[model samples]
Each structure stands twice: as C-alpha cells, then as structure tokens.
Target: MPLNIDWRQILLHLFNFCILAIALYFLLYKPVKNFMAKRSARYEEEAAESAKLKAEAEELKKQYSDKLTNADAEIEAKRSEALHELHDYREKLVSEAEQEAGEIVEKAKKDASRERKKIIDGAGKEIADMVGAAAEKVVLGSTADAYDAFLNAAEKSIEKEENEIK
Candidate 1:
C-alpha cells in the first residue's frame, strides 16, 4: 500500500465540492430564502390588518353599548311617564265616580224626604175627612131618642181622636 495520498485526487474532490455548493445556492437556496421572506411578510401584513379590524370592532361595540344604554334610559323614562299618566287618569275617574255617587245619595235623600212629607200630608187630610164624616152622621142621628145615645157615644170618640191629634 502507498503511504502518500495522490495530489490530483484531492484537488479534484475539492473542486467538485465548490461547484456543487455554488449550483445549490443559485438553484435551491436563493429561491427558498425568497419564498420564506415573502411568506413572513404576508403573515406580518395579515397580523396588522387583523389588529386594525379588532380595534374597529371594539369601537363599534362601545358605540352600540352607548346606544343601548341611552335607549334603555329612554324606555324607562317613557314607561314612568305612562305609569304616571295612568295613575292620574285612574284617580280622576275614581274621583268622578265618587262625586257621582255622592250626588245620587243626596238626590235619593231629598226624594225620600219629599215622599215622606207627601205621605204625612195625605194621612192628615184623610184623618180630617174621616172626622168630618163621623161628626155629620152623629149630628143627623141625634134627632131620635135611640140615636141620642149613639150621638153621645160618637161625641166621646171624636174627643178621643182630637186628644190623640194634639
């Protein structure tokens, strides 16, 4: 076996390694690096756009919240106003009904009093007519002797009724 390496073989292998490295840099390394750079840039742009969209969404949410709050307050105020109006209307209706009832009671009382007065007047007139009729009969009967006793009895009844009237 030869102890010393051949110089030509060593030089030839080194030359082949250099040529392969250069070819790989041009064919694979440069394109792969460019593709990686473009992909990274696209990712960065997407991230920036996503962040902007998120901020816009947050602003819209705040605006909607404010509108909702205002709407709730407005609805509450309107409800309160409606309730107050309803209460007032109910009170007014109750008051009017009470007033009408009072009027009806007063009218009924007046009518009862008038009716009672008419009944009392009619009773007095009836009593006077009955007494007058009894007195006339007694006076006519007094001409006969047997009727004289009946006249005295009738006179006594008249005195009793007069006392009762007093």
Candidate 2:
C-alpha cells in the first residue's frame, strides 16, 4: 500500500504462471524428452551392431588372408613333391635301361663265342677228312715213300688253312 504494490494481483499472476509451467511440462517437455531418449538408445544400438559387423568382417578377412598364405605354401609343396617323383622316375627308367642293355651285351658276347667255337670245330673236322682222303688216294696209287710225301704235303696245307681262318 505504501509503494502502490498490489499483493492480490501479484499472487494471482504467480499462480497463473505456475499452472502454465506444469501444463507445458506434461504436454510438451516430457514427451519430447522421452522421444529424444528413445532416439539416442536406437542410435547406440545401431552403432554397436555396426561395430560388431565391422569386427566380423575383419575376422573373415584375416581368415581369408591366412588361407591364401597357406595356399601358396601348399602349392609349393605339391610342386616339390611332383618334381621329386619325376626325378625318381627318371632315375628308375635309366637304371632299368642300363640293366637291359648290359644283359643284351652279355648275351651277344656269349652267342659270338659259341659261333666261334662251332666254326673252329667244323674247320678242324673238314681238314682231318681231307687229309685222310688224300693219304688213302696216295697209298692206293703209289708206294710207301709217296704216301709219306703226300702226308707231309697234306699237313702243310692244313696248317695254311688254319692260319687263314684265324
């Protein structure tokens, strides 16, 4: 009253402001806050899922890289094994060929020796028959001295034939 202040009007205006604040809190502020909270939670979940997917992709990539590295090693090992097998096969073939060749050479030598022996025996028999026939003819046609001379001549001819055959 002294400063022209009206207590009743001030109290009425304060009460009206309090009612408006409570209405706004329930009608607009609370719903907006809840919507924001839900949106933040959704974003966090999506971020976590994205991170998990990234980690899985990285793990898969690492596994594939390791497989590729192992593949190279496996390829090299297979190649080495194949080469070694080929080398061994070549050696085995060579050894077999050499053995076969040696056997053939040995057989050829035996055949040649057998043929030489047969030829020598045939020549010796032929020479003996010829000398006997000559001695018989000389004895039938002439005297004992002529027979001795014919035997000496036949002996000389046989020696010459043997030398020529050799």
Candidate 3:
C-alpha cells in the first residue's frame, strides 16, 4: 500500500500460476515424455532387429560366395578329368590302329612270299619238262649223258630264275 503494491492480488496470481503448472505437468508433459520413451524403445528394438538381419545376410552372402568358388573349381576339375580321359582314349585308339596296320602288313607280306614260292616251284617244274623233252629229241644214242646234261641245265635255270626274281 505504500508504493501502490497490492500484495493480495500478487499472491492470488502466484497461486493460479502454480495450479496451471501442476495441471500442465500431469496432463501434457507426463504423457508426452512417456510417449517419447516408448517410441525410443521401439526404435531401438527395430534397430537391433535390423542389425541382426543384416549380419545374417552377410553370413549367407559369404557362404554363397565360397560355394560358388568351390563349384567353379569342381567344374574345372571335372573338365580336366574328362579331357584327360579323352586324350587317353585317343591314344588307345591310335595304338590299336597301329597294331592293326602292322598285322595287315605282316599278313600281306606272308601272302606275297607264299605266292612267290609257288610261282618259283611251278616255273622250275615247267623248265625241267621242257629240258627233258629237248634232251630226248637230241641225244637218242647217249642216254646217260643226255640225262646228266638235262639235269644240269634245269638246275642252272632254276638258280637263274630265283636270282632274277629276288
């Protein structure tokens, strides 16, 4: 009252401000704080779950990569093995062909040799018959000498035929 100050009005206004503060704390501040806490907890849980999923994905990726590499190596090994087998088979076929060729050549040589011997024997017999006929016509008086001469001539003819054929 001394300086126109109304102490009663001041006290009443202060009391009203206290009531408003308390009401706001309970109605707005507490609810907002609890909502924020729940939201933060949910966000943290989602982050943990996301991290776990990411880690599992990374593990699966690494495993798949390893398997892919191993598969490539396995495929290469199989291809190499197949190629080696093919090469071996080729060699075996070549060897068999060579052996067959050698056998064919040997058979041909044997056939030719037998044919040559047959021809030589036939020629020798023909020459002997011809010489015997000539001797009989030329020397009717000296039979022994004629026979010896025919034998010598036939032997010489056979030797000459063999040498020429060779």
Each candidate: RMSD to true structure?
A: 8.0, 6.3, 5.5
lDDT of 2 by residue, 1-166 (tens): 8888899989998999999999999999999999999999999999999999999999999999999999999999999999999999999999999999999999999987887787678667766676676677676766566567656766776686577557
Clashing pairs in 3: none
Ranked by TM-score, the better of candidates 1 and 3 is: 3
What are the lDDT figures for the candidates, one per model?
Answer: 0.82, 0.85, 0.88
TM-scores for all candidates? 0.58, 0.65, 0.75
Worst 10 residues of 2 by lDDT: 141-150
Ranking by lDDT: 3, 2, 1
In candidate 1, stretches whose alpha carbon ends up further than 4 angstroms from where it belongs are 1-16, 61-74, 120-166
Candidate 2 structure lDDT:
0.85
Tens-digit lDDT track for model 1 on 66-158? Answer: 999999999999999999999999999999999999999999999878876866676577566655655676675543543555466556656
Best by lDDT: 3
What TM-score does structure 3 among the candidates reach? 0.75
Model 2 ranges off by over 4 Å = 1-11, 121-166
What is the C-alpha lDDT profile of model 3 across 1-166, one tens digit per residue?
A: 7888898989999999999999999999999999999999999999999999999999999999999999999999999999999999999999999999999999999988997898778887877686767677576657666677777777777787778668
Better model by lDDT: candidate 2 vs candidate 3 = 3
